[model samples]
Target: MKILVLAIDRDDDFGVKAGVKGPVIGRDSCLDAAVKLSLADPEDSDANTLFAAIKLYDELKKKGEFDEVEVALITGHPNVGVESDLRLSKQLDEVLKKFPADGVIPVTDGAEDEQIFPIITSKVPIISTRRVVVKQSPGIETTWYIIVRYLKEMMSDPEVSKVVLGIPGLIVLLYGIAKIISIKYPPSAQIVSSTVTGVVMLIVGGYFFSKGFRLKPITSLVRIVSRGLITFIGVVTGFIVMLGGAINVYLTLESIAENMIGGIPTSELIAFLIYLNAFNKYFILGLGIMISGKIIQEYLRRDPHIWYYIASFLMLPAFWKVIDLMTIYSNPLIKKSPETLIAGVLLVLIDLTLSIIISIKLREEVKKWSSASS
Candidate 1:
């Protein structure tokens, strides 16, 4: 087993709380430093300083040299008693004796990096870096991952996780409601609903972009590019399918006129319904995959497995809707249903199934790459 130690100065507390506990540097001193930091211009002292500590830990973990590593943060004022070096050395010494691992590493991001160097020598390796991913395992319990652990335990609440999920759910609900209302309302209502849905999708895209950019575990440029390209292809293909559906509808209408059929033929309507169903199926599958791709980008940067699991979970619901839509003509599952809706559902299902297969394969490839590299 490998041991990872985090030595944090008590005075560096910029209002963020950490998991590990240690000595106090006096509340007054902490307050004074925070006030100064707040007044400082052009620099974000809090996040940057915390980021330094996280960077060091992440780099070491990525090296994959250890069977297992536990991280801890030590807080206390080094200037309170003896020399700062001696003080940290003694604190670490006590910790090492208890753990007794093959190797001991101390990670710090304090103003006294140089001060603590002399104290930690060949026996303990001290490192500093700026690339860090702060997250808590969503527990190994059930299917519902309800909690999030952030860096330094600053945002460790389960409610935070719930809120994040809630936001997306709210967006989907509002869009659904707007769409339903538009059917009963005027042209203006339909336009407003469409605009609202587009805006929500954009916001969702932006959220994924930030996650992809900041997460560090996935550091592969090729994988990143592949994910983006796949989403783009999905979007383009979906558009083409929808266009084809429109053309099919026009051709069916013309055929009816040329044949001089007194009324709409059952076969023509069936064909139209099948094509329409196919169009909607592809459209929804593309949208879901595109959104999931954005999320996966973030996971690639940070923890790829998390979003992989999430996307897998969402795949089923989208697929179910498509199947239900397209089977309307052939199945009597939903009684008194117009064949159009059934056709749409069936068409969507086929596309969703294909996307699901592709997603699973891609996830396996990513897993292999991650394990080999980290």
Candidate 2:
């Protein structure tokens, strides 16, 4: 369970300018050229760090030095604001501790020896890999150089780069399409489209993503199946929630009508009123809980936080509308649908509570699992 963590310095401003950061390579001409430089001669700081790690891993494997080794890319940063190396190192330390592998090695090219060495020494075995020989096969040396040079050229080319990079974007685009289609169709259609799109995405996107996570290659089948499962679960969950909500809404409207014609019960009416008045406040809190769980899940799922933030922000309006609807139905003063309000609140509360509990449980489970597996 010896693991090597390589943090490549792929910080190109194009990623920032293109508004695509975290685990994504940049798209600007300058950024592409920078990536090219890293690939070509290992001139860039980030590229050198990654190259050293890759080379060291290969060398160790060739020599049968680390037969039971696992390698991974490590990108550390703050959820908000710019993160420094110290903060990044702290996060890395925490990750390694949780994993508790035989040893932890960080491969950063230009990190200060003083700053990095102590941090590494404090944790586990630390190998700086400053002058590590990544490739030294006598016969393949020339071929390796030529290949690296060619790959650099390919990465620099707009068309090739687009093909290389656009796979994930395209997969995302197709997923969106499939989701949109599924929502408008039957269960069969939804399952079929989602399965097909998920498979296609896993194939296309997995290739690029694997390259991005070069050190640790995840199987294509695993990626595809996981995505399909998620899609299936999401569709099923949506259907269940919608059907239940509809039934509750109907019942609530009936009760509201009955109360209006008859008389409002004091206890039920008061509860309904309180819910309506605090709908926005409580629903927002509930949504926050739900989203926090989702974020944690995404992190565990290997998705970048930046992307998670963007996606969550985009869905906020829709979530708010749903909240508003539920609140309206539950409002005792505006409507006499106490039953409907109760049902909606209960549904949302249940979901929120479950997500939180599951998240906490998963965290503990993963820590234990990783430690045991390590």
Candidate 3:
């Protein structure tokens, strides 16, 4: 039986740091790759994994348990996803072609590298696996160094930094703005402070919500912008409009706060209704604009989802009317009538009926589009 000791570098640290391309086959080649990698980055664990593979190869050869023992090193792309796995697969295939082994002993630095085990197992039976963990000094300095290094890495990663630093920085900036506004207008200080606190809580909650679901808004935005100029403009304009709407609500609330003689329940309720009315108007308009752009883009691309966008667009007016009615009914000071309620209900029913008809009419087309896509 022949055994091949395979070492993996899933992130291509060797190539990125030491300018060494893999598959580094044979004992001497593996040793050279390991030495060069270690010399390039003293802290990289891939070098230790390569050295472990070499040591394992020697031990197995010495034991005389196999007909032949060989060692090889394979490096992957830095992206560490499908691209990295593809590269690693190609390198592993190249190594196997050079040395046909009965079984493989996969050696990896950590779980990241171990992810390619299935790729290896598909080609050759796994005799065993070895995970090489470089033991570190248990000292205060070492612990502090590791902590600082990871913190720096987290700061460098865009996704991690957005939640860790960006959100907090934004919250601080908002607080400062609120402080300045309070100084300029003393009567609205309490309202501004409360609003800012609410905003902060919202930001924190949103961050956790996105994180929990692994939603990558930044990535999705980038993808959208890359789709075309029209889509990009629509998204940007919609967001700007929405932001303006939010500012409008804040200013209107501040003005209302200033005019209120006392913080009474009825006044608070009325103020909240006004805020909702403002939000509904701008938010719906912004969403409509954004969806319009998406509709145009999808229509041009001949995407089946355009029908869904059209349905949503048609429904927005009805949504707005419903919210308007709610605000009107909830406001104790505002005069409400049966005619207004009837009008709103009729408008909603019309919109719903039209949307449902459109969807039903396009259902067959949607199915055909989906089949073509598949």
Q: Which run of 10 residues does model 3 get worst, by summed lDDT? A: 256-265
Q: Across residues 179-266, which tens digit of lDDT does each residue of candidate 3 receive? A: 9999999999999999999999987897798889988788888887787667788878999999999888877775643443233325
Give candidate 3's TM-score: 0.45
Q: In model 2, what lDDT does residue 293 have?
A: 51
Q: Write the per-residue lDDT of candidate 1 for residues 78-117, one digit (tens) a residue.
A: 3432454455566556655655545545443333343455
The local distance difference test score of model 3 is: 0.85
Q: Write the per-residue lDDT of candidate 2 for residues 157-186, one digit (tens) a residue.
A: 876766766665676777777777777775
Q: What overall lDDT goes with each candidate model?
A: 0.50, 0.51, 0.85
Candidate 2 at residue 220, lDDT? 51
Top TM-score prediction, candidate number: 3
Q: What CA root-mean-square deviation does each model show from the true structure?
A: 21.8, 25.7, 13.4
Full-model lDDT, candidate 1 = 0.50
Q: How accurate locally is residue 36 in candidate 2, as Cα lDDT from 0 to 100?
A: 54
Q: Rank the candidates by TM-score, best first.
A: 3, 2, 1
